[model samples]
Target: MLQDNFGRRFYYLRLSITDVCNFRCNYCLPDGYECDHDRDFLSLAEIKRLAAGFASMGTEKIRITGGEPALRKDLPDIIQACKQTNGIKTVAITSNGFKLAEHLPTWVDSGLDALNVSIDSFDPRQFQAITGKDKLDEILSGIDNGLSSGFTNIKINTVLMREYNAHDINSFFNYVKDKPVSLRFIELMQTGDNKDFYQQQHVSGQHIKNQLLANGWLPTIRHKAAGPAEVYAHPDYQGTIGLIMPYAKDFCDTCNRLRVSSLGKLHLCLFADEGLSLKEQLQIDDPLPLQRRIMSLLNDKQATHFLNEGFTGATKHLSMLGG
Candidate 1:
């Protein structure tokens, strides 16, 4: 196992296939954002080799992320490659659900084990305002399609902001109360592009928890998961609720994952800007050298990030870092 100095065994990998996205969410990406076509993204073969390497080192879970992973024509191929890797027990995707309906069947056939879709609000106007897209109905239909297509572990991710979609909390819970999907409310993080907005609208996860408690939602003890979300359930509801408060809560003590950008830079922490270039190391004909280098870098992983200290080291956009 890839154990860091702090004894955190790294087994989860959040791999970003591409930085290109279909929507310009107010907090994640800037408006009129254009992906640089000239930048080199990791090819399928490189991604497979790296994934296999990580699996060999005791990594069991891998979540494919992106500005929007479904935008890639070869996404199904990528999913299948990760799923087929030895020692990889789970393969999932975090998507915007823009073109999810069209690609859901292919993804399911490719051995997708779980899914998390980004849906900020139930109201059309608020949804459009949050995501800068007018396809609220399309996203809703995609959710239904995902359910009908047999995705059992589907989750809906909602980022809570004080001035934004925070008021939609009750409506969001009401909409998913009878559904088999879990609704996760994420606390806004201070990213390079959204720092100002985050400062202005950040909402504490404790407030959301209090609201749920007031609404008669009881906390439930659940099995430990790789992700950072604190989960809850109510007997009257068909699905559960989760809270991811990176800012309000210190989940770093339990951090057990690493992230690799689409361009092949390995990030030790989501808020950390410094990363090792695994793509450059992959050029060598021998795989052992690259694997050894990865292990060495893993040992140097920082115990925690400085987000709480208001540290912003790199100017790269959040999409480039991969969520």
Candidate 2:
């Protein structure tokens, strides 16, 4: 198993298949995707090898992330590739849910175990304002389609921004009181280029957490391979709420995930300044060198991201890290 010197176990891998997203979210890519250099993302063969490498090291969960993962036409094939890996148990994807209702059937056939869709606001105009897209209705319909298609664990990700939708929590609560989906409220984080914007709009996840606790939402025991969200359940509600609060104290203590860029760089943490290029090792078509390299280098992984200290690291935007 891949265990850091700090004794934090690694069981999940968030792999960014591409950095191309169509949405122009205010916090992420407000101007839409701009190719800085040749985005020679990993090929299918390389992805297969990478999945195998992680599986060999006891990684059980692989989350496919991207600027918007569904943009790739061959996404079903990619999901199938990770699912076919011997030791990989759960294959999930995070997307903007661009055409999820249309594509979810094929994705389910390819063994996708879970889905997380980004929906920043419940109000259509506010959603359009935040995402630069007028597809909130379509995305919500896609989520409904997921429910009808047997997706019992569909998660809707909402970035909590003071200026955007933080105060409008009632809309989310009412929506979730009936649906069995999970609503995740993520705190607006400071990326390398978003310092000014972060200062202007950042909302602590604690704000929402406090409200939930007061409303009688009880924390749920997390599964061993779950991601970094602190989940909660309410007796009267069908859905659950999750809070991804990076700035919360002891947030990094349960670090169980590692990130890989679309170009094959291993980012030890989302806010890590440096990443080790595993591209050369990925080309060998063997899991040993890749596994060994990841296992060895993880000893240097930081015990904390130091997000509270205002360090945003090399990540210029959420899209760069597939957030």
Candidate 3:
């Protein structure tokens, strides 16, 4: 098992397969930004090798993230490879749900364990304004298709921003009242390409909770999950509501995960500029070296992130860091 100096056991890994996204979310990516086609992403063979190494070192969950993971033509193959890796218990993906509808059946067959879709707003204009795309209908269709495809653990990720989609909390809850999926509201973080926008529009999770409470929603104690979201459910509602408050509340003490970019850099913290490069190490035939490198990096994991201290780090965009 990989245990940091702080005694936190690391079992989860968020692997960014690619940084290429189709939509330009206002906060995540700048408008008119194009992904560099020349960038070298990790090959399927390399990802499989890394997954096996991580699994051998006590990592149980692997969540595939990207600018948009579905954009990768071989995503199903990637998921299947990770799922088949020994010691890896669950394989999942976090996406913008742009192409989920078209790929749901194939992914389900690929041993996908869970799905988290980013849906900022339901209103057409607000959705376009936030994501710089007019595909709200397509995204909604994709989510419905996911539900119909029997994905029980599907989650809707919404970033709460003041004067933006914060007022749509009740609407979001109402929209998914009968669905089995969980709605998770995430507090806007200081990272990403548009830090200025985040600073201007960031909303507190407490404010969202207050809005839900005012609307007769009751909170419930829920079991802790691999992610940071705090879950809550209404007495009469069918779906549960969750809040991920990275800024409003400190979750670093209980953090137990690591991230690896597409280029094979082991990120100890989401907001940290430093990381251990695994690109060259992965090329070696021996797996022991990669395993030791992972252990060494975990030992050096930051006890707490400095996002609260106004340290956004060098890798600011979510596209580069993965969602």
lDDT of each: 0.82, 0.91, 0.83
How close is every model to the real structure, measured as TM-score? 0.94, 0.98, 0.94
Candidate 1 per-residue lDDT, tens place, 1-323, comes to: 78889988888999998888878888887584576655588799888888888888888999999878887889999999999998999999998888667878789999999999888888889888988888889877887887876777889899888887887678887877789888899988887777789899898888878877887887766332368787888888888899988875557888878888888888888867676789866665466876788888887787787778887655356677556
Where does the lowest 10-residue lDDT sum fall in candidate 1?
A: 217-226
Off by over 4 Å in 3: 35-38, 211-225
lDDT of 2 by residue, 1-323 (tens): 99998898889999998988999999988888999969899889899999999999889999999988887878999999999999999999999998889988899999999999999899999999999999999999998988986787799899999988988899999989999999999989999877888999997888788999998999999987898899999999999999999898999999899999998999999989886889989898767899889988898899899999998888888887686
Candidate 2 or 3, higher lDDT? 2
- Backbone clashes for every candidate come to 0, 0, 1
Q: Candidate 3 has what TM-score?
A: 0.94
Point to the candidate with the largest lDDT.
Answer: 2
Top model by TM-score, which number? 2
Decoy 2 TM-score against native: 0.98
Candidate 3 lDDT tens digits, 206-273 = 87778778878776664323787777777778888888888655578888788998878899888877
The candidate 3 region of ten consecutive residues with least summed lDDT is 217-226
